[model samples]
Target chain A: DARVTQTPRHKVTEMGQEVTMRCQPILGHNTVFWYRQTMMQGLELLAYFRNRAPLDDSGMPKDRFSAEMPDATLATLKIQPSEPRDSAVYFCASGPDRGTSPLHFGNGTRLTVT
Target chain B: QQQVKQSPQSLIVQKGGISIINCAYENTAFDYFPWYQQFPGKGPALLIAIRPDVSEKKEGRFTISFNKSAKQFSLHIMDSQPGDSATYFCAASGWAGGTSYGKLTFGQGTILTVHP
Candidate 1:
């Protein structure tokens, strides 16, 4: 099946540790997005990229959080010095730049900071 | 501000019963509305979607009811099965800032439990 793929499906780390989550968007898809899902806050968009260029990241914390698409098929979200409050499921989704295409998401990486 | 508001944080239904979730939006510019279903340990999947231009759309047992004037929409799962139990999120997307790239704003999801 053609779907977005994520790595490190689950992770557990102590506070102040660095965490990295990766995603592989479906081939030929031009737009990628990173989102954080939490029970209290619901789903929120962290960053969006088009053609490997970040169009908006206002929702992501600038100091410790960064999202990048090093190549067409790869996208990554990194957190340095993670905190317990940052524990949540991080999802990656991809879609076509044009048309009314709905996003196809990866299984997501569940991160727990203790 | 929360762009969209969802009702009934959760719902419990018996098998062969109908399940419904409602959502309302504040932005009239939102043209694309979609509902996503997520199971535990999985990412949300697109279940059904509707545009403001259409009042209602149905695909098999899933139906999307839209009310353009109220800026509200709802999803109805007919004859819900145990497998239908999941968390459902309603999302809206539209172009902004002179760019065609659309950003989705999601609602606080509703959890549904179907009892067999």
Candidate 2:
């Protein structure tokens, strides 16, 4: 079974450092989503893409967060000047199409800032 | 801000019992509803899904009961097993044009524990 793969299963960085997480979506999947998971807020969608193009990123913090799909297989999310409050698990999910399609998720990268 | 609302932050059930979780959505434009199952440290997997055209859809031991009029849907796990224990999330999506083929809105998750 094809799976969504995320890099750096765990990450720890300083509050002012930069953090970049990568995702390799399942082959043939056309859509990708970035979400943040915290104990208090559950899961929140930060951004999403389709066919390597961004669709909606309104959920993301425009100041420091960016999501991109350089190619069909690669999707990346970057956070600059990470804050302690940014500590959470970042998840990447991909799907073929909307409507009846289902998303396949990765193990997620656990980010912790001090 | 919460377009989708899910109840029972957590649930506990014995083996062989039926496990049920419910969800309601405010967006009437939502045409597709899906339930995802997530294990610790793992990604959420699609368990079952339903469309507004139908009231129910089933796969193996999992079944989705959807009530379009009420804008509500639920998952029922028949003869639940300990292995079925996990966090379940209910989500909704609408078909969008172009690269944005689908846009999803998710609900707060519900944790289910099946005791053996």
Candidate 3:
């Protein structure tokens, strides 16, 4: 069974520290999405990439958050000078860009910023 | 701008009973709706989905009821089981112009607990 893999399943960092989360999408998937899950906000789309190129990142905070897919297999989300409010579970999902393909998600990376 | 709204932030049902979750969307442009089931520490998995063209879709004990005119949809699980207890989310997507075809807008989510 193919699945999206995410690293650093759990991360704890002090405020102002930099946090990086990594995801390896399914081998043949062309679309990658990054979402943040919080109790107050539910799940919010942070960014997405199609064919190794970013299609949107409007939901992300440009001043501190960034998402990049350097290659098809690797996608990363980074937060510089992370704040306490950044604590949440970040999920990475991937699927085919065409039709109504369903997204396969990683287990998620839980970040706790103090 | 909460495009999608889901009711019953939490629900409790006895085993062998029916569990229903309702969701409404404000965007008429949304053409696809899907439900996801998530367990603690795990990612949300696609359970079932329906398109605006269809009024209902079912797979096994799970079913999706869609109302295009009302902009509402619901998930019904027959014979609820304890293993089914988890967080459920309703999501919608549609053609929002350039490269926005599959971008999902999720609901607030409902936590369901099944008691024996």
**TM-scores of all models?**
0.96, 0.95, 0.98
Using Cα atoms, each model's DockQ against the true complex is 0.70, 0.62, 0.75
Chain B of candidate 2 vs. true chain B, TM: 0.93
Q: Give model 2's docking category.
A: medium
lDDT of 3 by residue, A1-114 (tens): 999999999999999999999999999999999999999999999999999889899999999999999999999999998999999999999998777889888999999999
Off by over 4 Å in 3: none
lDDT by residue for model 2 (A1-114), tens: 899999999999999999999999999998899988888877888899878888889988899899999999899999998999999999999888744677788999999999
TM-score of 1: 0.96
After superposing all C-alphas onto the true structure, candidate 2 shows an RMSD in angstroms of 1.6
Superposed Cα deviation of residue A102, candidate 2 (Å) = 1.6
- In model 1, the clashing pairs are none
The positional error of residue B46 in candidate 1, measured at the CA in angstroms, is: 0.3
> Candidate 1 or 3, higher TM-score?
3
Q: What TM-scores result for chain A when each predicted structure is judged separately against the true chain A?
A: 0.98, 0.97, 0.98
Candidate 2 recovers a fraction of native contacts equal to: 0.53
lDDT of 3 at A100: 80
Model 3, position B15: C-alpha lDDT score: 99
DockQ value of candidate 1:
0.70
Expressed as tens digits, the lDDT of each residue in B1-116 for candidate 2 is: 33888878899999999999999998777778889899999978888888889899999999999998889999999999999999999988766444342466777899999999
Task: Please write out the lDDT profile of model 1 over residues A1-114, one tens digit for every residue.
Answer: 899999999999999999999999989999999999998889999998999999889999899999999999899999997999999999999988785687888999999999
Instruction: Tell me the TM-score for chain B of model 1.
Output: 0.94
lDDT leaderboard ranking? 3, 1, 2
Best by lDDT: 3
Residue B55 error for model 2, in Å? 0.7
**Between candidates 2 and 3, the lDDT winner:** 3
